[model samples]
Target: MHPVSTPTVLVDEEDRIITVLAGRPLGDDWDEVHAEISTLLHDAGPKVGKPRKQERRGDYTSLSFGVSYGGGQRAPGNLVQGECSRTVIRDISQTKAVQRAAGFMNGCFAAYAPKLYEEYRSNLSQLFAEYPHLEQIFPNSVFPTATFNCGPRVVTLDHVDNTNVPFGFCAIFACGSYDPVRGGHLILFDLGLVIRFPPGSTILVPSGTLRHGSTSTQPNETRQSFTQYCPGGLLRWVAYGFQPVGSAKPALRRWFEEHHDERCKRAVGLFSKLSDLQQDRQAVFSLKGSV
Candidate 1:
């Protein structure tokens, strides 16, 4: 039998965050989600195959487009290039087909993953309640958004959102494979935590709090997942479509600065002790700066 569950909307006093694991498998709504995704893909039309070539050490480009559905019209926007090769920005409310797709996806999350959805809603509400400044800009609980990152070997460079509102984000992995050997782990740089989520597993991350990215994949390996950002404050609404901006930048910068200093001190101490272990050999000097 499933364990007695707590109200997912309540925040943990220790971490001041809310996280809920659903009691049921997301497969309960898999058919509905799949159909909606299929319709959206069909409306997206034929994707012009284009190889995403990396232009710089950390920069890669891909072709993408936007799907907007609202007021009984399913309008497909012109294809545009993005940082990832297989990315596409889908605007659900701009097209009837997309609106249906969004509704289906939202329903799946709310029904099959009610716990996760509740946590997301609770966290965002709490954030806005505490940070009244954010509500002034983004009064809506949900933000108008589009996502364009989904493909094999897709790499999103380390970055932060461009808003001051506290937001909760989630990524539901639907990729069929459950193997750890597959390159689909979500890496959280700030916490040094790597999460390997199998298909049907949903991860709730405190957006504007964590810096994360995905691992690279082998050839012929494709990964599928859905990511959504829920708004918490007014600033979030005002900053929509501008870029990800927030206090996270300064916070991350400070963390890295202090972290590097600590690492330097440790390295110096380790090197001094290593000299004794190596009989003060000149050969060990070459490995001193390795880390």
Candidate 2:
């Protein structure tokens, strides 16, 4: 594994930060924390039956709680807002272990991608505040949903999570005992970058917009990943005044149509560039910051 003393930022043509390869910032106790999370996952086991083509290998558990859209229904019927918990870790002990891991990754997300993290927190707060019934997997976690790639061998195919918020960032935390150099490298096809991902490291990336996956672990090695993200449908629900687009008033619908492009630009603007990282960090970590 390449020791990363500082974060490696990837930017697009417009200098918009697309990915922030956050290094191992878990401090001296990283090994202990990784072991605890690994043990929790092993005890919980795989929640899914078979490996899909996109997943390549190993089973996964998606613990989601938020609004979702587009499973092929008519306009108004398509959008649905509610809890969808497919998590295998249900015991109180297991839940706490998972939450601890999530908290660590959230801290890294806040540190590396301050602007995007801030927007995520604001959007999440607004969604939950307006709709009190929505279930949050972890109270401290900023992301609305989380997925545990429970793996004796967890490797994925290059694909984009199109259902996730396009401009939003997803936090991925690597766990288990895997050799970073031999395998377990993060591959970003769109950016043409292959990043050596050491165990206990966290990275924040625009998973919905980029094609990404990881390399396979070597023989006798194990790799697991925990990922957190928010579904795009929830944001759309907020934008449409907490209702499905089809049911929204005509004036509201018209406004959305007219301002869609402007909204997209603003969403893109939330990403912090490399040059602005210092200022963004200060803004997010200041005493009066929103967090």
Candidate 3:
């Protein structure tokens, strides 16, 4: 279940006006999440080495699963945690892939990671208020997400998540023993912000619109991050009665386009009220005693 929270605004000036939040402490499920992930670090999780990694632009290795729509000539479908095509960028949402990924996050690749999955969604749901559009857009739904990004000294280049829904919030949970102050910070290129993203802290980014990435850690240091995102086409699916945007009637399409300015204004208004900023930098290294 999601943790109870009364929404409030908090700011982190150290970054470019980014919101930091705290809810259920990360330690509550640290052992389970880490134990599940440790197995994939050596041999890759669901499949062989670098097959999943080949599609990505960075040095870190990862596995992702979600429901997505659109590309050059493709249609959408229900996706399990598997390989996505190279030209993908459409409706992405919380799909069955998340369930499998979640199961792994809480254990070895041998079983499902239910405990961590629930907490991830529960803690993440609190931030939904900032983007009120999700209620009408996704309606009764769970958050759409990305993958388990793991590697030694991970470094990703700056880029925008071009496929995510407009004004939708993406949650990123940082983990591993990399130094926050000296390295492993998230940088938003458009905002000129360098955020000291501590391990074990979760931060929300409108990844669909913002151009962001992270800095490098030392060769001997470990840096891992877990993140989830929603795609824009998902919003269209909701707005168009559970169908892809291309299927919209000509009249309705014109109507939506004519009012685009008003829609965008509403989105900006909602974003202005965001708060609950948190800074979680500490580590809970070993849970062997608890095990």
Candidate 4:
């Protein structure tokens, strides 16, 4: 393991690290990628909206930024439904957004940042081997699309990504500077680890194992990051509904029922408590049709 620093590298026995030598310029190709991102943000700006704040009640973290690119129109809506409570961008052409994102990523890799990109590639390759489902949705190249957001209000709570597929996700931190004291570092809950990223730094994580969140920012500071989901194997296609399952709904339902039984129990308890209160009170209440 490398000694910790403001910008440190963490490599476990199974982990890999890639380092980009300093002093190398990003080169001119990045200019084009930057321009395309700017255009996409500008065109998709109107639809970018803020998420509604709600009490945190789940075991997952909130998403601070969102972009409706790649896969389909599902990204933006999924963010909202997932209770990210903030959408920095939305409703852009998924294909265009991904192309620009991939170009930017490639540029980053070609620069002295080859080490970091190699680490990212290695992580993805490993994840693919473990989760064959990702191969179908991600193909050979993983070009994910995303948006950026940061502010005192922009927040992602602590949580981990679903582990149904194999590959871990890589996020490129773009746009703004990150201050450790400001609580913008990525907290790895399980390891009691925190990574404070500098602007343009990329972080690779085993999405399923790492529970992470962005701490609150400074009053005026903003954190911007772009996330890429690298599907591992055939499971990725199944997860995205790209492949059909014959009469698997029952099996899926049973799986959820078993895994989520605790959650269901909690909900049931809450419902029962509410019912008891209603019965104990003599207060007149309007009856809803279904109830």
TM-scores of the candidates are 0.44, 0.84, 0.63, 0.46
- How far residue 273's Cα lies from its native spot in candidate 1, in Å, is 45
Of the pair 2 and 3, which is ahead by lDDT?
Answer: 2
What lDDT score belongs to each candidate, Candidate 1 first? 0.39, 0.71, 0.49, 0.40
lDDT agreement of model 1 with the native: 0.39
For candidate 3, the per-residue lDDT at 243 reads 51
lDDT string, candidate 2, 54-118, tens digits: 34323353333334455553221212322222434344224555677678678777776787788
* Tens-digit lDDT track of model 1 for 1-291: 222322232133333333223222323455354335434433332353324664321233222232222222222122234433233342422444334334433443443233334444444454445544332111222322334233433445554443312334443333423253576666677667665544334454544556766666555544444444543332332222222333345765566567876744542332222113233333333444311
In model 2, the worst 10-residue window by lDDT is 75-84
Candidates in descending lDDT order: 2, 3, 4, 1
Clashes of 4: 16
lDDT-best of 3 and 4: 3
Better of 3 and 4 by TM-score: 3
The full ranking of all candidates by TM-score, starting with the best, is 2, 3, 4, 1
Clash count for each candidate, listed in order shown: 20, 0, 16, 16
Report the number of the highest-lDDT candidate: 2
- Indicate the TM-score of model 2: 0.84
